[model samples]
Target: MRVIVDHPGWTPASEPRRTVRTENSAWTATAGATLILNRVGEGRDQAPAVDTYSPMDLGGSIPENLRSALEEQGPVQRLRTADLWEALATAIIRQVIRADQARLMYHRFCDAHGAPLPEAGPSAFPRPETVLALDEDDFAGLGMAFKRRPLIAAAGAFIESGTKWAELPADVLVEEVQAVPRIGPWTAGATLADVTGDFSLYPYGDMAVRKWAAHASPDIDWPTDEGTFARWWRSFAATPEQLSALTVLTLALGGPRGQDQPPS
Candidate 1:
């Protein structure tokens, strides 16, 4: 299915791709969109294609819970693009190694493989097989953990099965991804952000985000529960239109090129 992401200002004039997780958190995340979203089953080539997206289906509708206050904070700013599988590799490497180390490893890995890095906000995440086939000892030489070898391999295998990482149902992908070696909720969440364009996840593993939460409330600490974070996200929107608006805002505020804070 072609997925055309619906956001206020962001438009996917470019192809969809995986988004990179950077030390620059302020960057807006771009969602991968396709024609499937606009399909009415009659055929997309037809004039004025199928339209209308429901909140329940998108997981981005307005919030009506006690978290109504969440909307007052701001919208989720995001870019109009994503880098697909490439983002997954970077996210995994980040989890396995320090940011600096991960970046170095990624560059080196890309260089050796001839996938020179892109200057854009994001690029396609490498398939798991490509990374898994690498020499683990090489990363070890960079002081990265050796334990990640299995995780990387697992990711490669997962992608090999025509697994649509970005488009899979969240529950299924989350469960499956967390099962991979060294992968957990955070890693899976990042993968989803790049692949599916589902923005409900706040990418909870960032230390910088944790610190932001700590500062938000003394009672709240890093690694806060999903329930709490969800509630916080709820406030980012008040209506379906508002939710879309926040998606744009959240990405913009997060530092589209500078530093990105966790969705407020």
Candidate 2:
């Protein structure tokens, strides 16, 4: 829930903004709603406003045919993180690794570097410069693999690129992420989906996603190729991001393996 703002004239004070900081708080957003604040800080009234994100518009973009199914699966919403750098870092950790293991390392990374805010739940993931400051030994202590080459390399490349994720289109974001060495389509696609909040691009390299698609919708001929999957995803649902969430349902419901638990 840590919120980071990167605009020239704005900031979120390096912490997550919560409508309800605690369960006992009086303030509460309506059920199944994401509240977005356009501006923050003591004098945000004078600062240039950040672009507003509306979930209402996001929901409307979904194809009618998939509405029922999406709803049946559960309420789905996009959460805008302070920065995509954490997403990119976690994606790198997940490359060719098991989810549980990757998750452990991800948490460890956050714990090692995150700066705890006064009331925010957990510390926000450290900034890119904080990560870049660490050496191999420091990263290795956090249970990272490959001497943390992929993470450090990717962080360096992303930092050098100087691209503002808020401004990049899906395609350009894909290209930008993929340009980094050792970061392929799967890594790039996952990063783009997270950073840009665009799930149209399928993670072709994700075995779980492919397995889910094969079992969830056997009627449709799913292709292993990334390009083909992108076409099917776009045509099937205007908001392919929903498909990403649906796949989680499929996985939870037992995908091609036909069991609640995914294959080890």
Candidate 3:
């Protein structure tokens, strides 16, 4: 898939619709801001009805100065989550399944049951119970682990418990998702970015973060902790605009995306 950060764009190897790349951002266990980009209404005869939230201002938004700086560039168009639960699920599937088959299954699920919204209406996110209605083999057929069931089940619990979709604070979201079986930093941040627009959720802990960091400073002795790596990012991102620019810079110049993610 192609990610156009700003002026320069990178054609990420894996299809984002199916497989999500943790390295696409800057941190492995980012602040739970996983930006989900969809083709808008241009894909699979189905369109999502959810609003696209920016990663910079999820649940507990960023500081005003930082948020303004990030917003200076206008907006980064992303997918509507409510319309494509299968695609979102596909991101997890990508982690579990083989590369060649992820996109294929993505299409299969959408083609078979995806429901498009009205021209001006909101999109759809499948209910956890509805998703769990599927047999275990259904998820396994996608070449991923059986965690899909639990993941969906958890979403149901979250909804049933009256969890506000937009009220999860960054720290709370991180703690909540971390305890899940397949959720690591990357997955958690990715989810946050997509749903809440938490811009600070960098790295999302993908391989690209390490690669870009290495490329940026081949001479420095690498530090192993998240704290050390983030220090490097703060250097380039003193301002929010710099952080936005850094997302573009890291992708094209191989610099660090934030704390853990590298350039793709």
Candidate 1 displacement at residue 255 in angstroms:
3.2
lDDT of 2 by residue, 129-205 (tens): 88778887888687774737777777787687746754677788787777777888777776665555444454632
Greater lDDT among 1 and 3 belongs to 1
**Higher-TM-score candidate of 1 and 2:** 2
Runs in model 3 deviating more than 4 A are 1-91, 94-105, 116-127, 161-163, 179-181, 216-227, 239-245, 252-264
**Predicted structure with the largest lDDT when compared to the true one:** 2
lDDT of each: 0.43, 0.49, 0.40
Clashes of each: 51, 2, 37
| Candidate 2, residue 225: how far the Cα is off, in Å | 7.2
TM-score (all chains, Cα) for each model = 0.51, 0.62, 0.51
How much does candidate 2 score in TM-score? Answer: 0.62
Residue-level lDDT of model 3, residues 83-177, one tens digit each, is 12232353454444443354454444433333334332112333455565666676677543455654575555454542443356755765576
Better of 1 and 3 by TM-score: 3
Could you tell me the lDDT of residue 216 within candidate 1? 41
